[model samples]
Target: MSSSYAGQQIAFLTQHGKEQVIAPILEPALGCVIKHVTGFDTDQLGTFTRDIRRPGSQLDAARRKARIGMELSGLSLGMASEGSFDLDPFAGMFPWNIELLVLIDDRLGIEVVGMAQGPGHSSHVQASDWPAVESFAAGVGFPDHHLVLRPQDQDDTRVHKGVSDWTGLKASFEQCLAQSGNRQVFVETDLRAFANPSRMQHIEQAAQDLLKRLQSCCPECASPGYWVSERQPGLPCSVCGRPTSGYLTEVWKCGRCLHTSVQTRTDCAFAEPKHCASCNP
Candidate 1:
C-alpha cells in the first residue's frame, strides 16, 4: 500500500447524510476522495433515538461501518463516523456530544480512530401545545435546527421526526398533544450531522486528528500513523515530589508496527500540592 492516502478514494458509510460535513475536512487533509454509501441502513446498526441501540463502542462501530463502506465501494480504504451524547466527558454541567471518526486501510491492516467532543445543549423538550412548542423550539435553534418528536402517551408509538418547518412543527405539535393523552411531548435534537452544526464541527476535528496522525511516521518502524494511543498518570507534586493522579506522559504508538514512545506531558509538569495525597492527606 502507498504511504499516504493521496489520490485514493475512500467510502463513507452513512445513511444519515454525513458526507458534506465529513468530506470538507477529510479530503484536503488526506488528499483522498470521499464517497457516501447510500445502500447501507446505518440506522439498523444503531440509532440515537434508543431503537436498535449501537452494538459496540464508538470506535468499534465506526470500524464496522467503515468496513461495510469499503466492501460496497470495492475500495481498500474506508472512512466512517459515530457519535454519542452524554452529560459531558470532561468537567461540565450540560450534556455534550462525542463523535468518533475511523479510517480503515485493508491493504495495510491498520485502523485509525480519532475522537472529539463538542458542547451539547438540551435537544429535548416537553411541550403541551403550539405556544409551548414554539417557545421550546426557539431555545433549540428552531427552523434552522431539526427535531424529533414522540408522543409521551404509554400507548402511542407514533413518532414525528425530521421536523424543521413551521407548518410541520405545528402539525406534529398538535398531533403529539392530541395523541399524548394530554401528556408532554418528547422532543429531541435530530442528531444527524447535517442537522447539527456542532456535531459537524466535532466530526471535522476528528478527521483532522486522523490526518495529522497519518502524516506522522514512526521513528523505529517507520510507520505512517504514529501518535499517542494512551496516557500514563502520575505527575509528582512540585513540593512533596509524591506521585499524584495527573498525566505524567503520553504513550505514542505506531499503528502498523508495535513501536512505542513516551514523552512528558505537554500540558503540565507538576501536580498541584493540594492534589497530592501525601501533601493534602
Candidate 2:
C-alpha cells in the first residue's frame, strides 16, 4: 500500500455515487484519500441518453472532468471516470462497455489513464403496451438494473430516467406512451454507475488497472504511470516466417522524460497461418 501519493488527497469528480466503486480500490492500493467533489454537474459534459453530446473523445472528457474537480476542490491531483457502450467490435452481437479512469497530476504535468473493456448490459426497446414493456424489462435484468423511458419519437425531449422498481417503470411507460403521438415508449437500460451493477463492476476493474499503472514506475526517470504507449504489429507467420498483423512489440514509455523501451509479447511468439496474407491470399 506504500506509494508516492501516500497520504495525499485526490479530488474525484462524480455526483452519481461512483466514489463507492472507485474510492475503495484506489485508497488502499495507492494510500491516497479520495475526496468526492459535488455541486459540479458532470452531465454538462455529456449524458448516457444522448441529451448533451460529449464535446470530445472519452479521454478528453475524463481529463476535463478531473480538471474541474481539481479546480473546485483546490487540489493538485484529481481523478475522473468516463464510460462508453457500443457493439462489441470482435463479437459483433454483444454489447461492449469501455470504462476509462483518469488521474491528472497538475503539479507533475502528467496524465495517466486506466482502461477496461468487456461485455456489458446496454440495450433498448420500444413498446406500446404494458406486456411488451414488462417483457423488455425482464430481458435487461430489471430492478437490479434501472431503465429510462421516453417517447418513441426522438424529438420528444421529455425523459424519465433511473426507473428501478416495477411500479415506477410502469408509471413512466404509461406516461411516455400517453405523451407520444405514436403511442410507443422508448425504453433503455440506465447506464449510470449507481443504478447499473454491470457498469459499476467495469469501473472497479478500471480502478484496479489504474492502481497497477501507478505502481509501475519508469526505469529511466522513476516517474509514476510508465505504461505501454504504442504497439508494433508484425508477428511472424508460423509456417512461412513472414510478418502478420499481430502485435510483436509493446513500447513502454515514461510520461515525464519520454524515454521508451520495446518489450516482446510474452504470451505469443508466432502468428497463425490463417492470419498471414501470403498464406491466406
Candidate 3:
C-alpha cells in the first residue's frame, strides 16, 4: 500500500542540521522529498541557551515552525521538530529530554505528532575556578556535546556558546571568569540539535516514530496516521478478578477522516496483582 505522501514535497524548517537525521529516515520510507527551508532564524521562537524565551507550549512552537516552513516553500505539507529539557518525570533526579516532530497536512486538514523522551544532557554548574569547570565538562560529555558559558550565572547575557574543543572551552571559561562580578562562571551543556548528540539521537527516534504513524493506513478511510489515540482501563486483576489500573482497549483514530478502531489485547487478559488498585490497597 503506497502512501498519499509519496512523491509529495514536505517542507522542513530547521537550522540545526535536523534535516540530516530526519530526512534520511523519512524520505526513503515515505518516498517524499524533505525540502529543507532555512531562510528564517528559528531561535526567534526559542533557544536552548535561554537567550530568547519560548512564547508558547512545545506543541504550539512545533506547529508554528511547520506553518512557517509550509508558507516559505508554498507546499501543502510540512513538518517541524522541537525539543524540551527538564528533570526526568519518574524521579526528578536526572536531566531528561523530550523531542516532538509535528507534521501538518494542509490539503488533508490534519496534524500528526511523533514524540520520544529519554535521559538528556541539559545541566548547569557554577564554578569559580578552572579545575571545577574541567570536572564539570568531563562529567557532562563536553566537546562531543558542546558547552555554553556565561559570567556569574545562567541569566547573564554576556555568553560564549558552542564551545566544542577543550581549549576553546577553557578560554571561554577564563574569559567569563575574568568578566565575572563574583569570580564565577556559569557553564551548561549546549542543547542545540547539532551540538548535543544525545538529544539528536532522540530526534531521530521521533522521526522513526513519525514514519510508523505515517505508514499506518486507516482501515476505514485508508489514510495515514492511524494510530492509538486513547486507552481504556479495565483489565481485571489476575488474583482478585477485579478491574485494575491497566489498559484493556486501545482506541485507534485517524487524523484525516476521523476514523476509529478499538483493539483489545489478546495476549493478556488479566493485569498483575501489583497493578490492581483494590488488591494492592
Best by lDDT: 3
Looking at model 3, report the run of 10 residues with the lowest lDDT sum.
1-10
lDDT of every predicted structure (CA atoms): 0.80, 0.90, 0.93
| Per-prediction CA RMSD (Å) | 2.5, 1.6, 0.9
Judged by TM-score, which candidate is best?
A: 3
Q: In model 1, which regions exceed 4 Å deviation?
A: 1-3, 90-93, 153-155, 266-268
The C-alpha stretches of model 2 lying farther than 4 A from their native spots are none
In candidate 2, what are the lDDT values of residues 1-281, reduced to their tens digit? 32668899999989889899889898888889999999799999999888988988999999999999999999999999999998999969998999999999876778889999888889988788999889989988899999989997544689898899999998898889888988888898999899888998999999989988989898876779999999999999999999999999999998988989999999989999999999998
What is the Å distance of residue 61 in model 1 from its true position? 1.7
Which residue pairs of candidate 2 clash? none
lDDT of 3: 0.93
Better of 2 and 3 by lDDT: 3
The full ranking of all candidates by TM-score, starting with the best, is 3, 2, 1
TM-score of each predicted structure versus truth: 0.90, 0.94, 0.98
